[model samples]
Target: MTLPLIHTPYAQVRQALLDHTEIALLDVREEDPFAQAHPLFAANLPLGRIELDAWQRIPRLDTVVVVYDNGEGLAERAVRKLQSLGYQRVSLLAGGLQGWRDAGGELFRDVNVPSKAFGELVEAQRHTPSLPAEEVLALQQQQADVVVLDARRFDEYQTMSIPGAISVPGAELVLRARTLAPDPRTRIIVNCAGRTRSIIGTQSLVNAGLPNPVSALRNGTIGWTLAGQALDHGADRRAGEVTPAQRAQAAQDARAVAQRAGVRHASLADLERFAAERGRTTYRFDVRSPEEFAAGHLPGFRSAPGGQLVQETDVSAPVRGARIVLVDDDGARAHMTASWLTQMGWEVWVLDGVDRSAFTDTGPAPATLPRPSRPVDWIAPATLAEQLANEAPGQTAVINLTTSANHVKRHIPGAWFVLRTDLERALSTIPSAKRYVLTCGSSLLAQYAVEEVAQATGARVLVLEGGNQAWADAGLPTAEGEQRLASPRTDRYRRPYEGTDNPREAMQGYLDWEFGLVAQLARDGTHGFQVL
Candidate 1:
């Protein structure tokens, strides 16, 4: 049965933000369109991904969720899906995206605008020290006593880095910086793909009161390239183990910073109490490296490496005003990450004094969800290949429900890329066939859509056994590029700093955007950010 859609006015949403109450303003469009424009605090939970992500992102069933789309007729569908998944308080943003604009709301461009804006605010308030790429390069040329720390993920560091930078991702900076540069006179420079992590990471060291002078590599690698400086590709340098004494000192320093920033320390009992508060949304994150998280972690804690957590808080925790509990075995990482969270207006706590044995769970954090009520028909890769080879030209319709980018990168040779939300309409454009096959990155998403597709088409519907990955692993031929597209490539937003070939204007414009975030934050007046 379809539930009557509840309409929430723009005033109510804005009031929720200003009042510092829990509100999840979800943009239900794909990433590309969402990135082009969204409210400052809006989180992108695309329509195709509601079933897979809604539960994990908005943990509470009663959490106020207002979903919007830019006149694409997706918000109503999203509301229905959320209702089906047990979201009790789902509502449509009255008048949709245009309503927010008409109500004089600020629409932010690019993803993670809240965190990026916070970083800019921190830099503006704290005057976080930074050195331009050219100046840093000159210092390197002069053999200055400096150590460059890449604050991005290890894979990102491996892709491109400064000539002599080491991969000490944002969260590791405070815990490992002293060990990386034992000499008190050594100058430290931190960087990321762009500005936010660089500012946040550098400020973290300074906030911890690290002795050696620290500064961000202004605008990060983007600045390096813009300044006609070269980047070292495939660099493997990473931070090593910290000595006991170093760990102790780092812990002490980080704790002091956390305290100053009003970060609370929670005991195991306190954590249990927080968990019991079903009325309040509490997210428990193991703020450690992915490898460390996979090795061992407390039960119920999700893996969100500290740096990325701070950078992508909207993605991780969409419900603003929710409580956050960060866990880490190491004394420093959690505290350092918590310090940033506190400043970002999160009611954050660091789990303290927990015995190592408490970490019973092992391997990657499990993604648990309710199984589909109806059984799904699945086709193995080999069987699909045989059917494709033997069947008539229009016998089977293989619809790829993965991201457009992923579909373009690699997919079954004759597969048509279609948005799961647009399946019925997209199918009308495809040739009639005897059977239809559905697949995504892992077929997890496609499995959820089996009933919907079967209902809409009244055709034999089957999911690919393991999706595209299985097809490739079976040594089957794959095709690339935009061969057949039923929907625009809007699933994933192409980041300005991701690849090597971004236009100079776009890069500069990106940097220019960062420069103006502070003003935008002021205009919005809802962000409860504080800098220590």
Candidate 2:
């Protein structure tokens, strides 16, 4: 039976934000759909991976939580799941997403709408100088002492970039810009896949008082592509580390910006107290590059590069209204990143005087602590092979719960790909069998559905021990491609920026979607932004 959903109207939700009340606005859908349309503050907590991330993302169990969906009936399901996880205060956004529209609420498009809108607003207010794609292309053609820098992730820069552009990511610009082009005459042009990062990055240099002539590539690579320009693929150019003097300048500039934004500097003792406080969630992030973080870093701090942290705050700190403390070996990155958080209406803090020698880790701490153990019946590969060889030929059924993409790649012979949600209806269609064996990539996912299957169909539902990996390791041959699918392939959505087979239409569609977010924010009017 579906559990009854507690509903909160858009008016009360909007009022909470206005009154500075603490609440988490969640969008429980896949990343792609969540990117297409969501509120400025709604965090995307996909239902498929909710079990893995919910605890770390939503640390305080008693915190007020509100979840919404695009009428997919996912909100109700998510509410029940959160309740099952011991969340005391949980409610669904009444009437799904449509209800928000009916109540005159604003709907935004694209992931990180808040950051993107902030960048756009910064440009509107500051009039941060920028040159259109046409002019930048001319400069590149002329080789007029211009150094192009991509402010997006390195992989994104490698995927598609302006010819001769170097990867300098967002926060790195302030620290490493001088060394890359020490000659003050060398004009600096910053770009990203789209407008936000480029705008934010260009403004960062301008705000830092860089001596070089700085300007954003108008609208970034999207505008470049739209202007019928070529993007270099598989480019490997990158920037080097900061010099001692450059580092000092970066630290001084960043601290000033953070102070101007009212971002407090917290000591180790202050952070300790914040962590120990009951009914409060505190996120400690090391705002440095992955390589720097990998060498050694703080014990509790996670590696979130300063640039990406500002761009994807929801992924970093899902608990809205929670205290955030950023750490970095170089004072620049953390303070610079925290400045953005402050303007974005977050209660952000920067750690001061931490010993760099104390840090000694490679990655962030696990999102959840000590996961609950759930037992799944063992189905060894050799035993399953013997069962498959039975004379009846249909006595035992093998169901794979891996992604459709993975199932299409390789799967056990005669295994039917199925979705956990559609397993009941799917079981009815499979040939009459004495037992049903469920497997995913590792059977971890299948284990969650095993008990439900037995309760519904009264069949002996056994989980494949070690799943397909064990089968392959046991020298069992597997099949390739989609042969049998018990459910439709609706579990995953294709990203426009993913893979190389693009028809140009999809890329343009993505840009068009981003172009509209500014207007959406205007209509929504609930975002409490104080641009610094």
Candidate 3:
């Protein structure tokens, strides 16, 4: 049965944020449109991905959820879907996106606005020091006493980095900086793909009271590129393990910083108490590296690398005012990460006294959801290839439900890229076929949509076993490009700093946007950010 629709006005939403009450302001539009404009706290959930992500993101069924769209007619459908999925308090944003504008709510552009805005605010309040890319390059040429640390993910550092820079990631900066540069006189330069991580990472070291002189590489790699500097590709330099004395000092400094930022510490018993709370939402994360997390981690703790968690808070914890519990075996990383989260208005806690014995779970966190009780019909990749070869042009329609970006990169040749939510409309556009084979990156999402497709078309539908990966593994012929797209490629937002081919103006524009975020935060007034 469909639940009654609830309308939550912009004023009420703003009040909720100001009160530090739990509320998930979700923009149920594709990422491209979502990145264009949204409220300060709005997280992009995307209407089509509700089933796949809703359970994991909004874990508590009773948590209040307000979904909106900019006249895309998606919010109403999203409410119904959430209700079906057992979410009890789903509502529509009263008046939608335009309503927020009508009520004078500040709308922010780009993804991860809360964290990015907080970074700018930190820089403004603390006047975080930085050096231009050209100056850093000149210092390198002169063989100055400087060590460059890239604060982005290892993969991002590998993609493009300052020549000879080491990948220390943001959370590792404070814990590993002293080990990387033993000399107190050594100048440390921090960078990322863009601005936020650089600013935050630099500020973290300064806040932690590191002896080395530190500064952010202004505008990060973007600044380097705009200054006509070439970046190193496939760089593999990384921070090494810290010595016992270094780890002890780093832990002491990190704990001091976290305490000043009003971060709390919780014992395992305290964590259990938090978990048992009936109405509140609590997110438990192991704030360690992926490899460390895979080796062993406490059960029920999802792995969220500390730096990425701080950089992508919206993606990790969409519920704005929820409680966050971070776990790490090394005392420094969790404490340092908690300091940032506390400053960003989270009621965050670092788990204390965790030993090796607490790590019971091993390997990566399982991505599987509860499978359907009814067995799903599936076709092997080779068999599907044979059927396609023997079948007529319109005998079978292969629908790919993977992300638009992945589909464009590689997929079974002739497969139509279609959004699962729009399957009914998509079926009408494709030529009538006797059978439909559905596939996604792993066929997980595709499995959920089989019944819907069958109901809509009354045709035989089967899932592609192991989806696109299995097809590729068999050395079957594949195709690339946007050759057969039934849906628009708006699932992923193209970052200005991602590739080498972005226009100079866009890169400069992105930097300009970052510069203005401090003022935007002032206008918003709901963000409870404090910089130490």
Candidate 4:
């Protein structure tokens, strides 16, 4: 006597999902079908990925997967793929998803896990609180008790944050929180556009055993906007800085802590002696985020993301076996990075830059930029503009090299970012067109971007001079922020191409390159192109 065929009726499947919180109910239907209707607990895995990218979507093969589709042939294929992949607890909802609805089961709409929901979850268990728009306004008016920590990049923070928020990215929280909130009585509040980082940031302090209570700005800037609060950038409101006395104390405290943590504190003489050793393979790491790294970092130091550097130091520096010197404008980053590296068994040193300029001891031959009066061998913006004027429509590719925030904030008519940190992932996703213009905050970065592209694949490369700042400052028109996720291509990690230097020419090189890219496009065929 055989039992019923072990069939999972729609009701049973629904019950199974509700019974196990860990179970993942996957909607295998195409977007249209899922948009129309899907199980309340289902996460969309799109039918196509169930075969190829399933492993990435679901890391644990044993995760209970109840797959379904809208009466299409896709679900069966998805199930077969899961079975082949050794996903042990895989099952099918006896009938396609429609059957669940037919049986009076509930359906969910627009239920993608949004950043806001995640933000709330992060705030809830993490003791993260957000000042509502009214509260924030009142705080501003009352000269409040809370300190807003803008957990975005320094540049993003510079561009915008709550009126009094300070720029404190996630990675820096563990290191800088102490200085910012010295009293522990100071209420610490973290914020990010959507969530993730803000939530993680607030939790870091709580996890660090810091006695201070921490909270995240509920919903970040978006939430602030939703609540009709005012936002500002450093342009109008600058980030808080440690005063001279505070800076001195911070430096002293940092040196003592660093020494105790096993990080070698090197004097200028010590650094010189180390540099004198010929043949010794030593790599310098500027452990700040790329934005800060670009703003100004130690001479000859390469940018290595702090988190990745901590996790995979050997990969980032194969000379990992070599002596490593870490530099940072403030002792916080240098010490934090050094502490982590010391634990990894590397010979690490922290250069004391509190009193000395990190760039002061450049060997006799200092790093230099091209002279503005230097002969213009590269295709100048004028030349590119002239040629572009002659070229037929659709014959050019537009590669914008501006920062994502800036690109979103404003950009040349059709420019795109050519060197995003996630270039490989973004390549397939970016639009393929005829011409490409490497862009950035300034033209030098654009040129640096062009060099990167040249090394990878040969395509038309045009560098914008002076970059976006010049264009905007010149009173030129610009786009106002990309409202959605941009092609990953534009999000490349740019270790080079900073804005401190001036082009031999171009009064407004930065802004012209980014905002006036369309004007540059008018010139297409000028010769003598060298990307330096």
Candidate 5:
């Protein structure tokens, strides 16, 4: 007997989008491949990570989820995985990516096309003001009243930024703009690595009804670099705190904007009702600074800085179309963050009117992870240390499945570093041993590989009790070098746009790719984007 076929055609998907119906148009490929070519609204949920990240990325079991790959045969496999996981409305893109091409749809390169393209659209439609990078530099050199704000994350800002730019991040722009530039006559300039966040950040201030004149640094740091300008590194300047009066005023202003975007506030009772809906996936995020969240945050909430949350929705809340509730110590941050999220096509709500005592968690929130169903043996750290110290060579083999960079930095002595995906084939080449141990920075990844390793090699497989960290804590020495690798490093891909060593052409190529996203989004026509 053959299994039934499920297909979602391009036209059907397009119609649903045009009609404003909800759908999770997913592309099941790795981040690197997914960056090469995909539709504007297609969220990448790689096949290798389906079991790991699927539940958190797609919340509703019955929601229409159309997954495709570029004829890589991953979509069908993903469909099976989703079905096994009890998803009811999973379907394959009719002809995979070829179907979209056949239907004359545009394929964009790089990630976050929706948000980036939306920025371009907003700039085009609203005519957000801007200055060339050179002009902005000159203004800074002249000690003009213009204040530059970096809209990227704090780390990214610290890496490289326009001269004298303070790190304000995307979602913080509206909340902190008034405090940063209280004078109505002060000019504000917003920027990011390239164009998206700069455009969005500048427009956010405009939308918030800031009295000062606002403009984006055209093309952002890319333009600054192209014009032979210098970028500051390791800059630690950040926006200062907002007072009680400022918080109240910002809350009122942000709440009005959220209302305009149809984002409602959720009371404690409303969130309780949401939590009760077990089948529906709901993500509750504390959208505050990492330091603030670590001091204490509401229970059952993950820490996602509001600005980074807007910049990387796929990373933060991968569950496309899931209901998101944002929490902030002050009401303004959540409301402002929710406003952008609402515009980005998310059903978002801000928690309001909660007492200060309601927030109650220490350290980071626990991760959302899935465990494999397998019977696995564990060797305690002390036992492993003793075995390493006393056992003869070739008696037991320890394989580290952590990242290559991390492995190079330090790993358990005599342990071989291998990629988890390549463990089976690589195992055959290694010297035979009576026992095998799998470990990572944590034991979670190692547990998923125990069954596979055991089945492939017919060996007694055991997991390190608490991974490599335990061995180190037990005073077991570690090794450092690339010579201990048992498999070729294929797990992590290096981004071309990162770091200071990138060639001029690669940087130029990245900008060219982003500048074309707006055109591709127009041709795709599946993205239901609205700019305010």
Candidate 6:
């Protein structure tokens, strides 16, 4: 029997990436090659891993795997192994990374945070000198013609920056810098939290082959902090302004950038119209931190970090060819994200004014059908307790999904405190349940556990609301026995920078990028920032 194959062109690969479609971009090159630079969506499983453990990473036998490498040697081997593993459809990217690059396809740097990558572009270029706090003070005394461009986000700039520095985020610098420093030699200086963005910003101008000599504020605000320099937290201080004409121009520029990257922006009315009448599935993602999401989000919008949304659009949306609309306050986060999504191939839109109004739950109701279950599950304490007390005349079982600390303090009788992380491999221990209740800290995890188990064995499963806390809060009885076993140690809670090599490396890069944030905030003033 012949295996399914799809040999796609560089343009098609780029389009698949922009659409956020379910196309696995597997780079067969070794880790080091990938770290230097590769397609943004590409994951380096390496040729060895695929030959040995392709099934582990590429678990779904039916995933559309598109293999590529710098050249072609390893990819052919990968396709054979993938085919052996029952991956029904597998194909090679026609020209691989070289082809994409040769076609003038843009490549993404290994920037950790999606937002931070945007922050990297907001400063000037130069071979200018860095002034220590004392030197800057001295320069002030000397009445130097230097202007401090605070290359940080607006909010951070508002909190504190160099007293006289103006704001310009890294991504917007090229578009806004000329007006801010129209003169050829303005003695421009850039500063961020620690350094990366400031250095990158200054260097970007130099690389742009700009004539002005720019310099980064050495060590940025952190150096200021280390220098014991005082910060100005005064209210009513104005940041740089974005005129209406400038706003219009910026929107146009952003649109063009999006086009280059394949991102789309949609109005609220357009989104509403799509949602109101949809033959195709449409996912409304709130691309913000969980803290921001918990603070408030648009109704019916699921909280998916921008990178995660782009990376796991298949799992998040599941429905192929769904329309994706992302909500964020400004164009930086949305446009930058939209750029990646556009390359993926989904009908994508970035909605403005997401944070302007409170979320009104007036949209169509969620599908009432039960979600497909998985092999493992977690449940709440209250629901678990109820299920335990009223089980059938068989050996019913229950597992506690709480921390060791909480389990030691209190747990339901006869319930084993299994770490929710172990639920997958530990499923073998689950006795043929008259039923099993998976209890956890909250209903959220428990609900997921129930779904997982249901998918695996069609087990009768239930999750408790409020989890163990709810049970304890209800004055439920406790068993004070020492735990005979330890919970499984899982890194599920740690969200790593999902880029090149290990997550730690990605996170470190992200941190380095974030360190330069305070400076970017100051350079790009916050006039047009809408929190929604």
lDDT of 1 by residue, 201-311 (tens): 999999888999999999999999999888999999989899999999999999999999999989989988987887799999999999988888999999999999999
Per-residue C-alpha lDDT of model 6 across residues 1-532, encoded as one tens digit per residue: 7665567787776665445455667776555555455654566665543433354345456666788877737678678767766777688988777876787665543323223333332322223345566676567568876777765555656666777777665544544555576576776777766555565455434433345557778767665655667656532333355566654554455555566655566777887787676244567777654445666667767666554454344335533345778875445445544554554445678886554566544333232222323444445555555656786644556567665556667776766666543455456665566566766665444554565456555667766667767777988776756553334422122223221123444445545655554454344222111110
Global lDDT for candidate 5? 0.80
lDDT of 4 by residue, 1-532 (tens): 2112222577665454333333456776544456455553466665533433455345455655677777766666667657666676677777767777777665543323222232333344445544555666676688756777766666767665777787776657666666788887777888765454566566555544556767767556655655666677563332455566655554455455456557887766777788777534455776767766666656667676554355334234432234678877767666655654564345788776445345443322233332221222244454445555688865654456555656777876555543343343444455554545555676654553444454444555555556666656766556665632445321222211122222323223322222332222223111111110
Q: For candidate 3, what is the TM-score?
A: 0.98
| Cα lDDT tens digits for candidate 2, 250-286 | 8998888889889998998998899789877888888
Q: Model 1: how large is the Cα RMSD against the reference?
A: 1.2
TM-score of 6: 0.42
lDDT for residue 418 in candidate 6, whole number 0-100: 62
TM-score of each: 0.98, 0.88, 0.98, 0.42, 0.88, 0.42
lDDT of each: 0.92, 0.81, 0.91, 0.54, 0.80, 0.57
Please give the lDDT score at residue 336 for candidate 4.
56
Q: Which residue runs of candidate 1 sit more than 4 Å off their true CA positions?
A: none
Select the stronger candidate by TM-score from 4 and 5. Answer: 5
**Error of model 5, residue 238, in angstroms:** 2.1
lDDT of 2: 0.81
By TM-score, how accurate is candidate 4?
0.42
Which prediction has more favorable TM-score, 1 or 4? 1
